[model samples]
Target: MSKLTMPYQCLKQCGNLLIAARGSTIETFNLESRSLVSSWKCPSSKPLVSETSAQEEVTAVESPAPAEAAPEESVIPPVKRRKLSLSETPAEENKNWKHNNKGKNHRQAAASTGLDSPAVIALAVTSNGHHVIAVTSEDKSIRVFENSYINLKHELKQLSQRTMPKRPCGLAITDDSSTIISADKFGDVFSLPLVFQETPIPSKNETPVPATTEADSVLFTPAANHLTVHSVRNRKALENQKRQAKPKPDSSGPEFEHKLLLGHVSMLTDVALHTYNGRHYIFTADRDEHIRISRGIPQAHIIEQFCLGHTDFVSRLCIPSTRPEILISGGGDDELLVWDWENGNLLSRADLKGHVEVVCHEHGKAATDGSVDGLKIAVNQIEWIMVGGEDLVVVGYEAVPALFVFQLTAANTLQHIQRIQLAGNVLSFIVNSEGVVVSVDTVHALFSSSEQRNMAEAVDVQPLSTFVFEDQRLVPGPAFEGAEQRHEVPAEELGRLGALLYGLENLRKREGDGRDED
Candidate 1:
């Protein structure tokens, strides 16, 4: 039997350290030495139970056992049973009803735990490099970890964990590192504090009961009665309503301090926070092919402008630090879009499908899998980096084993430079002063066909690849010395990796006339 290796899903670089997430673990490596530094695994989904609480439960059960073992002093006399009225029920009956309701609630809570194990889907580092934020899939939680790189710690110290109501697809930290902005698939964006503080519980004496007014003290009666409801069906509904217990107000939202910034009618795919002219702005892209710009923080409700040109879902957004006014967006479209976001103008579109077709042909696969008309390109990432003293743009596509490079022209257009082919699909990458470190899926886990996946498994492939610029083109760089260590992945967990790593394809709309698109 062969051991299965886990593929990296996310990568982030902080100074001389590199953080990578694969499976449910986060590993940090020292880039200078090219050695693994530390690893931290996410906690389980089961709620934690304290030792004291468990002891108390055991004591309660044992205390009842003693009473059951007690000997009877004398023969107990049989008490006369009292007949109950037709309108009243026995106490045992009510107890059974409450027990049944409790069981139903317990089952519902268990069902929502989901089948997949917790896997880190997204990662972000604070600008100060003092903290790291990770988002997990199973619990939909945002976790904060203290970065203690100077001390050479063995594991990251988790400071806090706050679960969100919906799964967060994108995460960004403010420049000041005081707040975290998260965009979810439910079409809502929320901001949370970097360090969460638990709300203190107040004593019963601290809470004052409200005084009853004259109207509150009076008995309430409804105007609708049997006479008002003429039909038999209406009267039956009225009786059922009266017998049913009133529903309680929902309190399932997050209890921590969080504020809603802005929302869209379609699912949000990415979010970016930028500061231009001393004012913070938020740029968001959605599956409905809409790019929205809004004022940050208190003024987030104000809509600045919309950059709309693509006819397909927009999955990635990039705002170059060198060119803040230029926004690059890509998704299900065959071309990459260049936009002057502030003015809501589409500067130019670069052809990406042609390059993808060439790569697919070389790999012995058709660009179109017979499901779509033309070759569909899902851009996974768009990053700006300086290579050979020239500003360049690097783009990676989902399930494509290649990285496309282009130069941003003075006229605000993309000029093709070079293409760096790899052995497997590009999962994620981080660019630094040294070179580019890419996390590749050598196992072909993202591929849909079984034949392609089997062929990839037959050959041994490296999970991490490196590249450097030479003569304005990408060339192979020195291998990361100690960063090639692979972690073993169990067979059972392989089924869930598809949901964690391959999600952009789910945004594709089916052939129908329906308004809703999943």
Candidate 2:
């Protein structure tokens, strides 16, 4: 993609790709012309309406006047034409929707060009690996990438139209890559159409269809089976009564519905697909700090059980290839939690305190900002838990472009770990069933282990390890409250949970070694 670059101008607004990098300050190349796109600053995932309403921006551009001015009255006042958006607002009433107009908004050019932000935090190729659906951490907007995941060389297309609940944290395209499901910070779950879109036939080729006066809606042509929702919860964890669990010999196998899976009090982070006794299920990652495995209908997406041990946010989850019921999760506290879908008990929690301790030992004391005791780090930090095709557990940290591998099994055990650090920060990485990990940095990408290690050990390796390790004061156990499984969790319970973490904080000593344990 780089060698083919030509020179091109920067884009007006690119909120979608910005969140794809987890709200980090990233510079994307105009690969065609090889020119650099502008830097993007993704605002937090607040309602877009909130920002628009609060801002009083300059509205229009002043047209240039002829140098030979004859009469002062001959000057034509600039047209007060409002910017038009096709999808939003009625055609007769064109209210502004997209921000920072590309042409003629001289008055508010500065604000529009302030930054180009990524609207999606996580993007996933569907189970069948056809479409790409992404969630923006900045605004919870869900953009369904228009290209199939079959070829990376294909031009990726995204629209700023589809949206999720709010503060979307995670996204998933279904097995067929047709349906998009995502989780928000509040443990709310949402679904959107992942359409296989195409441009209408050229006007010259075909007769136009009759146009309706009503605004054209973004519809899911092969719409979701909102009825016959036999089971909404995809977690195949429970043994259904023989009478009720009997697999219907229907052509489609399972039914579909627009059912609410559930909710968490804290922000939900991730969700995974599972199957039990030939039934599908879903497991959710939540701030309530629980790995909840649940199965039920949309109206009752119950939390069957929870794997709780992490003291902070559950950041990432990796489902295994060999064993469908097994999965691993990484926590904000640097701990990894392994869970068994069938059995809800905590499978294992890795002693990740050592990973950091060794780094601190090698680097002497961590670089402190000097202002706060927390080890100053990047604000939009992301960690990954990946499983290789042959059952290897891979831990990735964005701050340090590092990869750690462990032998993993169906029983949810990790052993014989190998560490291969890469140069620069691990901005993003992807692994498949075959034990291969492709890591991305500011510049180059490395797929082979030897090459990645060599890059990490390079003498001129640029470090992106600025992080602030503030004490994640143990909040109360209401942690999993943010996991989006069931929606009606009580807020009062969450408050009590917060109280628990606060008390634990006072009880646990902040060891000088930087490991605060409760």
Candidate 3:
């Protein structure tokens, strides 16, 4: 109680990054230094807790605590290595991606799993990897947690005191270590500088920079309205970036210095930094089916080129690490397009249309895990892209959300290697050198984004009543009466197929009987 109480006093003001899940899974990894630090694994089923301290203490005293006695399943594991900085040695990341594959594909169901609710909407961790921030689906508030013991298997000290707007989506911990930027479904975003009542900075324009620091800084998606740069430490350059004009209240809300970027009419899909020739460029994708690149600047300069090719909405987009200038875009048309981010030219393209067609947003859908509306996702939003030890880690949704591990060859094409299945559809994912962190729809079963996709294990689940299609004719089942109308399938062939089904069903029943007799 003392440890939990202490962090709350100052946790709100510190800038710590967060990794969250829709309901499937939540993990924290330092983006500045790519590595996983902590994870929240939901239980397999709800459990009953003994309120008495004696019971709780009994579990902790054990050398290796029983997995069931886990105080809070959302456990924060100790980070063995310092977070890998993007600018640091790339020998490791480079070695694996150069090879066709890196880590062997793998997937496992979460240890403890239950109904996906109280879904994690947002996540944040501190620069030093000591603190954690999480937003829940039910309340839409931010809670702070910290690591207190280095020797423990898990440590999370909660420090949340208030709630923010409901359904606030994107969250970023600024480099200045004070401000946190979050976006909601309405295309609106908020800039809260630790413990402050979210100062509504207007939503008619684009979201400005979210944080400030000496090294790598993260800002809101410039595709929307309002930009606020708030840091804990006083600075000179950012001070120059602020508007001299005073704050004025509008009929609806307060005004901000940086006007929102109005160019992108689509739902802003993703935000990433392109550090090229010693400068950083910001890139964005929207529902308007366009990808826009920003002039390399803290405030960003003129809108650069727009990459176009998709017939429908561009759902997912990323810049593969191996090919820095090259960008990947997945769309509603079930196609993947690669582009040259520099000149906005089409480089190489592929069609990923093997799955069922009704599944939309395989790449872009604005949602959080475990929420009612957030759980209805058919496809996953493009959450995180990591140069898997050797392959590119693509964490996304299918009919449900999932994470995928693939390799790119010298041909600069995606080589389908292994697929990982998740319990819930993958909503978002993040990767660093430590581990791959993924946020997914947790309403169903939960599996890691790193699982091997055994197509044979893809569960060609047999229906209770088998319907076989032979010679393009549907042998209708007994369930549908008078359904033999000749739309395309012939009646004799249908009967023959029915006979085939009867034979199979009988054979299955006989096998069951034989097993019982044995």
Candidate 4:
């Protein structure tokens, strides 16, 4: 599915709780109790109404006071001021002004573009799950929240918010929680400080002026307002011009709060930081089927090597918690690739047909092996879970209405383990050691379409489901291959032999029937 069709959504797990982003709100659920702990509404971009109100406030504060009226006796008696009859009052004038500007059109456009209600598109949590960070589409801001895991509380406290110049699609927090790195729609990866610090003072004549707000930076001055109505159309036009006027990259250009670490020609979907053998590396996946591994921190731009085996847009990426050197990734392609990114070796790959049945490309259309296309089903999200002494990868899909689990076997292979059927397309999910929490399209989709529905009856709002697996299977006793079991075939092998014998019998029966006809 295209990004526009899919809402900005993500899932992150911490201890016994899961934090999920659904539209404009972030919700937390307790995996143990299978209950919702809390939900926090994310803030959207500042409203267009705020622009007019802010201008009015500025006028009230900055306008010059009217000259004191001359004393009646000192000034010649002006003609008795007759109250001038008017067709409209100030309120009516303002109402007509808004109507003439077609404010409704602007509001509708904002809604259609998802500007009015931006959602969280990316989220990350620390190992302890005590800290959370997310990127919102509307404001293009990164917000950090403190999770009360120790206190076992319902609410999360927001620590800080930093706005970005471009809308970010993915973000990664260092395991130490010291820095946050994000990939934006502009094909750029940037790093921002997680903790606030004081800005250093510039020497005399070196202090750079701060950037102005969006409205003030582009809108006309009072003297120039008469030239135009200053409606949303003009505002948009000015904004577009401002964006197009951005300077090309140069060494002496103004710096940003986020330092550019690297860039790509295609849109980046996911970013991750991995540490192996005391060395840190940054892994980035893009829409053009490219996954780059680079040296972390100060040498982030230094090229290491690209994991080059994907045939479609690489969307979801995860490093197994138990195996730090291994990387698992899947996108629109039918298969997921396992790689030793640290050593640049493609370890193994597995087809997803066992889990999801969907055409990878449109009928009669030749599939492009390494190009971005709209015809394929993509693995939307992935997370690692350890259960039953097995390292499992929980996979969620964009077009499929179910979740699949694959175990990373000790033999270094990806094996299908289980599938969890759901009511609607899986949007996002979080898998902790304890259980899993999933978010779907809607609660109504979970039930039969023919169910008699009451318009006002409250649906159970059951978008969140927690499934816990606490029973760790025990190890089996030793078995001798040459003993009594030597003569017996395993159930799996027996089934294969039975299928072969059945096919031979069918062949012999067909031959006998043909001889009789002859």
Candidate 5:
């Protein structure tokens, strides 16, 4: 039986080390030596119990019991009785009790998933190369690891892990690497300290609040009785109010220190931090075609401006270090947009659909007469690189087996340069001093068509591919040694693995206009 291979979903380059995330495992490679340095997988799902707590519990149990105090005068309190109400009948009470229990059981089952493992969705490395951060899916956690060189070899030691309130879709670290900015699908952005700190437990000597108090009873008291409300709907609402008067359990948010930086009405797709004139600004893209520029950190609430030109969802944002004033954005649009983000101006738009069509034709996935319609394009990544003193922009689209290169003109416009074709769909890529290292899904084709053939038979495919610039043009470089190794799984798991690599197209909204968006 054919086996399924897990592809790399995230890639980062820090100094001489290259980091790649495949499923729940993180692999670090020495770029110069082209060898795997270390691998770290996500921790187990079982919660860790501290030894101190365990010992304290044991001491409490094994220690001698307090002497029995002499019983004071046996005073029997008088029993207070009240008449049974109509709604308090034993049958009605039992029915309500059963209903409540069912709801509670459902909630408990949804909250815990047993031993489901987590997958790494986002990865980052500090500029100093002292730490590596990764976000996991199942637990909605941010994991930090110490990237240290010990025993004559590199190693990744987990430092801390903190669960977030929501699953983060994009992550960005501050310029100083003091804080982490996370954006979730719920349209909120939060900033957390890079280092995790445990909250101190309350001292036992402190006074504890009473579980029940006289003032608490007032909350359950209804405002209107049967005398004031006579309508059927009002009576039904009153009954519901009485049924729901039970005290609810406290559902608190995350205990860790975090601040709400900013928010959007639509789901955020990407986030980038840029510094200009010694002032840092945050660029956030969303599914609503908005590219908002806000102040960094403490002033994140203040909106600077919006670069508005995209007609579809914006999935990726790129701010070149070489050109801080220029902002490149792309997503479901047919063209890549160039913006002067500082001034909120649209400088130019470069054709992306034409290039995509060219690739489809080359791969025999579209008609030869140039009549391809209902085709969707989503730019997954936009990266900037400098080759031979010239600024170049590399763009990769979702499910596209080619990397498009463009020249960033002095006028802040994009000019088509070249397209480096690959054997499979590009998942992620990182540019380093050596060249470009890309992670791809070699088992999948660029697009689906009636004439589409098996990709493995049509072209040579590999999990990892490399490219380098020669005379201002991109060419295939030497293969990355020991980097192509992939974890094999049963063929039945291919659908699950493919979903993790090719989900950018899911951001497109369907309007039911009889048109296929992706």
Candidate 6:
């Protein structure tokens, strides 16, 4: 089992380093040594009110503007206006700050911007492993940082940050690392530019334009006489020409630096970007059991196709590094569906219902149920791993909370090869070329019960599990070993049982004969 001090919020393997988030802190560990290399905490953001300006801010809040009375002619009073949103409150209004304004008031904005705790919930590493992006809990923002996995000090430098309009459910970085696509709970996918250029400096001799004219000045002046003197027929043609020349307004607006890539009716669960046959395609999974394939860039709204075999909310998606054409997805369903997504064909379906049997120590064997909450067999997590020059799919189920490994056959089918029963429910996992690192729920009732009984003595505790497959068997780490199975058979001796039976029968016959004579 892997040793973890706190519950991990997210985990990603970058090169030989393992990056993980625990609450507001991010830690980097040397994968080879399995030791902590570095750790960084999310800096607590405070409001811009400094000690010098504290009195001014307090005075402004204390003496608020008087409420304006409604006109007597109106029957109902005007509805009260809501407070300004975090994005509306500017940070250093007179200064040209590099960061955005949404994180100005740390306390009030924290609720929307997640600047207070800034706990990372989702993480994605670039294909080159030089950069990483993380989504903060409740902030609706994506933060890009330099991947300093090898260094113990100066581990990360904030490169770019984009605030989303809604909480992000999933995040994916493009293969080229030029753009990042994030799926939000509001059923929208947006793209943010990773590269930036410095703002151009204005010429010193040029004067700044005034933002507004005097209040008494007229806003709109009539057109010149020569411009308005065209005949009705000619004017109609000119108006039509002007209308045709005008460009349509793009979804990319001035309010945000990011552009809306696409949208779905139901909330999205995950998104993945892949390059196939020299073309880029984006696969998005939603809560309504819909998986959509679309163009990755430049008019991403065009839907290419849909993979619609799932019956429940699709929560996870994976495309093997070796097999980019195949897509594996799992959701509330008991089985996993492997698809040739490019052709919209169901290559194979793997049902894990009857194949898995849980050995519960307290109950001997766990009972099965068909209900949603009572479901004993359900795929909770799926990952595509390339191990020992072979492509394998790592799956975790809630039934026994065990891990199962399946090797992709030459015919594009899954073959179960190994299984590992975990002590707790599997929450998340990260698989790399070396081995699989699984994060499980160690505080479950059954697992914690043992701890409660053995608390008096100091002992090492591991909240996560790590396993490696060797000879088609799962072997735990050096800290633990698999329990051996033993069965006892009833003992029996068969020396004179037949002779004893014959003697007993002879005695019964003699007793019958004596009774007849009497």
* Cα-based TM-score, every candidate: 0.75, 0.50, 0.44, 0.61, 0.75, 0.65
Q: 101 in model 4: Cα distance from truth in Å? A: 22
lDDT of 1 by residue, 1-518 (tens): 44556778899986677889987889988777777788888867655666577556666654444345445775443433334321134667745655666523232122131322588989999999889999987678999998764564545779888889888889999999999999988789999999887656578779855456664455434457887899999888778766644343567877899999999999899999999988999999998899999999989999999999989999999887888889999999999999999999999999998888777777666645523335577999988887666778899998888899889988989998888888778889987645688988745543341213453362466677888666777778766555455576544335435555666876787654233221
Order of the predicted models by lDDT, top scorer first = 5, 1, 6, 4, 2, 3
Clashes by residue pair, model 4 = none
Global fold similarity of model 1 (TM-score): 0.75
Model 6 Cα shift for residue 518 (angstroms): 99
Which of the two candidates, 3 or 4, achieves a greater lDDT against the reference?
A: 4
- For candidate 3, the TM-score is 0.44
Q: Considering summed lDDT, which 10 consecutive residues are worst modelled in model 2?
A: 1-10
> Per-residue lDDT of 1-518 in model 2, one digit per residue for the tens?
11111101111112222112322222332322323333333344323554254333323233444577768767566546454333234734433433433343222221121122433345566554334455443343565544422444334545333444355556655555566666765676665556634344447867776454333332223222335234646222122221132232345411223235677765576777666666666678765567877673343376677777767666667776556666677756656667775776668766554564444444443445322134322111222233323355656553444555566754567763665554443554333322222223422233221122232343233322111111211111111111111112232212211111111112222333221111
Candidate lDDT values, in order:
0.78, 0.43, 0.42, 0.62, 0.78, 0.62
Candidate 2 RMSD to the real structure: 19.7
Per-residue error at 62 for model 5, in Å? Answer: 32
How far off is residue 76 in model 2, in Å?
Answer: 26
**Given candidate 3, what's the lDDT at residue 280?**
54
Write down the RMSD of all candidates, one decimal each. Answer: 12.0, 19.7, 25.4, 20.1, 13.7, 21.3
Candidate 2 residues lying further than 4 Å off, grouped into runs, are 1-114, 137-139, 148-153, 196-259, 296-300, 365-390, 409-411, 433-518
How many residue pairs clash (N, CA or C atoms closer than 3 angstroms) in each of the candidate models, in the order given?
A: 0, 55, 46, 0, 0, 0
